[model samples]
Target: MKLIVNAIPFAGLETGITRYVRCLYQALGAELGVQVGYLGYHGLQPTMPQAADPDLWSRQTKRFWGLPQPLIAAINATQRLRLERLLRAGCRSVQPRIYHETDLIPPPRLPLPRVYTIHDLSLVNHRHLHPKERLWLFDLFFERRIRQVDHVITVSEFVRREIIRDLGLEPRRVTAIHEAPSARFFPRPAAEVGAMRRRMELPEDYILFVGTQEPRKNLPLLIRALALVKQPTALVLAGWSGWGDQAWRQLLEPLRLEQRVYTTGYVDEETLADLYSGARVTVYPSLYEGFGLPVLEAMACGSPVIAARAASLPEVAGDAAWLVDPQDPRDLAEALQGLLADPERRRDFAEAGKKRAARFSWQRCARETLRVFERVAARKQARRS
Candidate 1:
């Protein structure tokens, strides 16, 4: 069956969703009997396949700024019209049986069956974290798209439950597909890790946290926990700063841990892999997550992980790492201290994590997604018949 994968989100710089779409498409593209076409505003670009080393496709594209508010609104409206025209063109040329909306935005009402992936329902549940104007627009446009789609897919069971409870969707109408870490996240040798450290100028020993600096990530609490640890390990945060730097600084100030914390802002895949490899331990104490990709990535890199027990974290970690209550900074601090002091425990966790990481793969995710596509197409055919 001909399938059109929506790729609008790729127009900007890389994010978690970008990696998810790129990995799944490349994995599915390698298979036989499935013709795939990427329908994106950015046009075609190089993508990484499963056979190649994950780092091979890790380069970042040029970044672009959005137009002014009113102008951006008009431009997006025009793009939506153009996308509709493009969909019509595809329907006539390739006659696709299914249109998968990889990003949350639904495709312009189309004749073909529609499938959407709902990464998280944070916008609805944790609306306070987002800018009011953006949240308003998201609720207006994306919420409608979620309800109108033929089928929905979520990355975690946590998100699936939220969608059903908040949006009143039927459980069967949504499928939960867990995301896997890139193959490059596997354990790296000491020499390789050292080379990456030199290239990125990362400290020789540190604790790591990788993700956007949103309040939902619970960075302030992690900072507090870091201060409580008696170890001399530096805290290195890797990701672009969102919201503002004030909250991060304010939390670190009172604890006198300002000098111990470092922010790398953003780094490429090679550097990121090295950061994961060389770190003493990685901690992810987010308040909520649809899926915790970093927990698995750190596990794959042979680093002991300490993640929050709330939301989908335990489902992802699966006894491989120390699970802590994110709401309690004291508990998080105690877990961090315990893991830091015990080398045998760290090694034990690392070995178990590698084994657990082995269970997930992008190829498996793609195959499950393809089954959903087939089901969506069959339902459409039944209605037509």
Candidate 2:
């Protein structure tokens, strides 16, 4: 019943992986009490049950110990030997039945059952969208390391299919466990939403897009679509400015959407809830996704969504969102125009979205994940018996 999750990713940036690890661990820890622990850069920390709020744990740790991505990679490379030693020490102390690898790095070769969660095959699928350094590490370790795991987990069925086809993993060996939005994202009161809007200097009614501004997010297509939309409603770009900002900016330049587009760089989850609640319609036209989190998050917050019919988005959005071709600006623009004009449709979608989002919860995700771990561990034990 004892489990140790490699939490070294928490020492790095607060990406989607970090959220997944934190949330899953919190729920698992709550369920299992002291039976679960986390293996960080230092060693083993059997302090799971103590984490009342996963976000609190992340805030305390990330601020105190977070490192830049490149530096974290360099440190991980240099500390592999040390890491193995720590792993051995942890194994001896905790005697864990399972080791969960949250990040893509291969689990240290050990007797314990291994569970590796592959968020996406973006590196393999879209090399141009990723950095050279990342691709280099991926090429060196991903294929070799992936084979060492006892079981694989993916965030979505689309990714599960990709892993099965590309890596040739057995279908039963890989499971797709969907992620859920934090409890923080829900319908905020109109008064609170108005306050947040004023604080961020956002328009009263705006279309919201939440994600890092990267090429893979398909920001250019969204920007082009925004220009094409005749509605005077503004577009709020809420997230960190990832790479490829120039290309998106170039597309935005000629459109003269400087006044129409509001860039609120990197808001917190609380702010995000307000943004989502206040939004007329939330648009996510990403080219690909392992799981389109914002689509669900917005849905949870009572925002009708229009997501791209690409990758796992349609699966995540289901019939709750207005699915449009990511490549076609006209399609996106028309969806926007239609959604903006129809209040009743928006209300219906909002209710349906809430109902759909209610189907997912971190507790559910944790329980299903635990079932996977139990099966893997029991299989290993059976082999020994």
Candidate 3:
């Protein structure tokens, strides 16, 4: 079967969705006796498995979503139209057994069996957390065309339910395939963890939060919670910048967490694994998530995790993690302080987390996803027959 994934996300920024598309495709491409192709570049030329990582993408992704006010909206419109035309033209020529879009937007009027991955309803349901440009684009392109998608893949059952509720799609049209921690995230040897921590110049003991600095992450609440914790540990954040730099500054300034908080910009996968393995406890206080990859990553690294109980987080974390209310800073602080006060409890959670993380794998995600594509392809074939 010729399975072509619209891997254009890998050709752009190294965001969570990009990582999702790349990792799933990498696993799928490795299968024998199947011709797996990628549409990473504008030409829709077959994607190289080696180029799945965004580091290898030739062009530095132009950050347009969060820009200064003076830039003309016309330029953004022009760019969107041009990209749509180029992608549509390039993709239409490569007729495959099935075409899968990793992101929300589907290809324009391509008469092929198509599958779309819906990460979350955050854009559709919680538009206030995002910028106007993003909301505008999604409203224009994604909302209408998404219904035309032949099938849908969601990261969690919560998202699958949300899709049925929000999109009014038939339940059978969507499948929930759990995303996994990458191969790089796992229990690292103590020596290697120490060496990497030293190389990164990280504090010996600190709370860890792995996510972009954004409003959706509820970082300000976490920051306030950290301030209230009487424990002597620092807070280490490992992620790229999103849209809340000013908000972050205001929160940190008033709290005066200059000595207690450390914010490291985008670290490589190896470093991220090390940071996860090194933390006293990893925290994920996001208000919502489609799947909450970092929570699983921390678990895979054998790190004790404390995540929010909202949305898909509890679904992902399951019984293995300490769940906290994301909205209440007081509740988050109590949980952090309580966990830190008991090392024995942290150790117990660590062991449980590792066991839980073992249940999910990229290979499994690929297999399930491939099954969905093949199911639809067979239907399309039977219709023609």
Name the best candidate (by TM-score). 3
Across 20-126, the per-residue lDDT of candidate 1 in tens digits comes to: 88778877887635677677554322243222222332232111112355554555566766776776676667778998887655565788888988888778887
By the lDDT metric, which is better: model 1 or model 3?
3
Report the C-alpha displacement of residue 300, candidate 3, in angstroms. Answer: 0.8
Looking at model 2, residue 205 earns an lDDT score of: 87
Residue-level error in angstroms, candidate 2, position 58: 15
**Candidate 1 off by > 4 Å:** 42-82
Considering lDDT, which of the candidate structures 2 and 3 is the better prediction for this target?
2
Ranking by lDDT: 2, 3, 1
Off by over 4 Å in 3: 49-93
TM-score, one value per model: 0.90, 0.91, 0.92
Q: Per model, how many backbone clashes are there?
A: 1, 0, 0
In model 2, where do residues sit more than 4 Å from their true spots?
32-34, 48-76, 79-84
Pairs clashing in candidate 3? none
What is the Cα-based lDDT of residue 274 in candidate 1?
Answer: 83
How many clashes show up in model 3? 0
Task: Give the range of the ten consecutive residues with the poorest summed lDDT in model 3.
Answer: 53-62
